[model samples]
Target: MTSAAPHLSILDKPFVLDLFAGPGGLDVAGHALDIPSLGIEWDKSACLTRYEAGLETLHADVSAVRRDAFESLPPEINVLAGGPPCQTYSVAGKGAGRKALAEVKRYIERLMAGDSDEEIDKDLKNLSDPRTALVLEPLRYAIRATRSPNRDYRPYDIIVLEQVREVEELWKHYAKVLEETGLPDGTKYKVIVDVLDTETYGVPQTRSRAVLIARREGLGEPSLPAPTHRAYEAKEWNRRRDLALAQVHQSTLDEETAPEPEARQERGDDLQPWTSMGEVLVTPVGTHPGRDTPFLVRSNYGSSSDPGRRGVRSDQQPAFTVTGKISRFVVFQHLDESIVYEGARFSMNEAGMLQTFPPDYPWSGTAQAQQVGNAVPPLFGAHLLSAALGLPTLAPEALRKPWQPATEEQRAKLRSHGCGAADDCTARCPRPE
Candidate 1:
């Protein structure tokens, strides 16, 4: 007798299990889309931020969680998403993951060969940076889910994974592995892998992330979401140069005759110009509220090729990639080296806003800058999740709107039961008594 076909429709509710989830960037998107999500994060500071935001979280290492724990959760999880720790592979850090790429590939081979977890764990411990092995945890979860012996087992309907651009090769290998090793029930996955630029999706930063999306065969082949905004171009800044001079050199222009560049302008064919720092930081989102002056950002860290020359970008451009060191960047009024902008360094809220998080997102604990910088932009995450589920993309206005604040009751709970109390306490903090 033939097994029943898997349910493959957007109408089916999607419950997300995000591994290595950091401060609810994707969870914020999930909430906006009205999807319930649970994130597993290991960092105390990140978990504290999640608590402040009222997002569901489990404060434990991804490797320590058992598949049976997931199997026991109510409502059932059908979606798997994660942006694993990328410092080892990032350009900003020592290239430990890059050096270990071949060894990592060998580990994948062992996993495919049905090697015991004990053997894999022993070898992974021997890697230069043990964190490099964490990238493979998602794959282990996927494999176990597909080959489950449980009578009611259902493999994830959608899988989304992202990392720094260097991990694109690994994601490609994952595509090959999933295709070659079909599900135990003979259903296969159609996978798409690519590097996505956040600015193209209307995020206010020009960050790129390697993304992989997989869906079961009956769900149809997955494709990357189409860009809804034009990519940021340096030439675009030249067009706005005179306007910046006008803001600084002359009185404010007449509102009716010459309006400040609108937050969004329609180009033909459902695309808008890339969002600028001025639109987010200077205007509506109000990183520098009530300030109409144009400014320039001086990056603290110079480019790889020119370490001596500091990188500079006008407010008209999308921000240079916001890194963990974002607090070190300095802002100036126009090109005048002598005049510092009133808000010289972006506040934590401003940095978070540039990452497409709401301005009021309650960032908690030390290393808040690192938390904001490491997060996936919620707007970009929303678009990816929508595309993976074959649903309509979120409205452009959704990106601009502020995220809802946590309820008073939720705030009281966080205050009363702090995440630092203990590991088990943090885990229980977000759940109902």
Candidate 2:
């Protein structure tokens, strides 16, 4: 088993409180970093998976949780992280949040301007999708942690947030607010926001997310994680495929066919090739019974350019964005498109693996597909968290390695940091034995 690189402990000791945490994607990354994490999620299905995995969890709605509630936890949470529900903002959904982007920004502006929750909630309740307003919840918590006059005002040292790419503008607005809000000590947060491709972070799917990372100025400069892997380009892949075909035909007439040069130069001096689905699914997970036979995946969703046509990807390429409806995707033997592959679709374990979850991850409860799809791939989350803390970049091999379950020592450390100890937890918060 390959071990992760030595963790560079930037913070004295970090405790993370994740909001709208679904099935512990970021939390898993946190565990790998030896950082204790507590996730608050409202989805019973996701919570079930969390419990089965023995992750620290508070199964409750983010909106219902008080902004200042972190004050009461046993250990002071220095890191605030979460990926808020992005259904309303995602293009695959109704696009209600996109439609209300301006209105939502106004709500964020009001929150930063000291608008009362009652006032914001009143108007927010009228949005087409109330979930659109929930995007502001992280900011609400941040404001209270930094500015609230409650006893012992302790500000978070770091704040990390992620959402669908459509929410990049809102994340920029968040960066603006966080940079302007100074802590009691007059030190402000250094903030950076960008749209990150999961594939660049070594995830086997090509999902894009808007990410914001902010660290207290005293800690050090904050920046997004550098991509460790080159992003996969479909056009480039197609071009290479056509060239290979042409070369094959010419080789019959000529004595020899010139070797195809590298398909494309690496994105960076040190970046590795983009990870393909075949690298993960074909060998480790055995998606195809014929070990040598390649396969093609027919995506359930359509592309922006061709809405009527279903998207297709070869096993040699990274998967299209994994979605809640991924179960609807079909797989075919590469040589025969008409015949469905033995494994027509991804199993729950296979689906979770595509999202960077461990193959043996315990996925319980209903809507398991949604749980897998909605997760921030743990591999990407690890790199993001490492960058936020001003730590060394995770080696590409570390990100690509299969996830292992938390060790007993890791569980003990989490308990020391107050995992699974929420007083108001509405669901089963299982303690590691």
Predictions in order: lDDT: 0.76, 0.75
Model 1 misplacement above 4 A:
1-11, 67-75, 147-151, 183-187, 235-270, 284-291, 334-342, 411-433
RMSD to the hidden true structure, all candidates: 6.1, 5.3
What is the Cα-based TM-score of model 1?
A: 0.84
Model 1 RMSD, rounded to 1 decimal: 6.1
**Residue-by-residue lDDT tens digits, candidate 1, 184-302:** 44556889999989999889888889999898777777878878788765554555555655655555544323234442233455567788887787765533363355787888776
In terms of lDDT, the best-performing candidate is 1
Predicted candidate 2 versus true structure: per-residue lDDT over 81-177, tens digit per residue:
9998898998878899999988888887787777887887778779998878889888778766755455256778899999999999999887786
Worst 10 residues of 2 by lDDT: 423-432
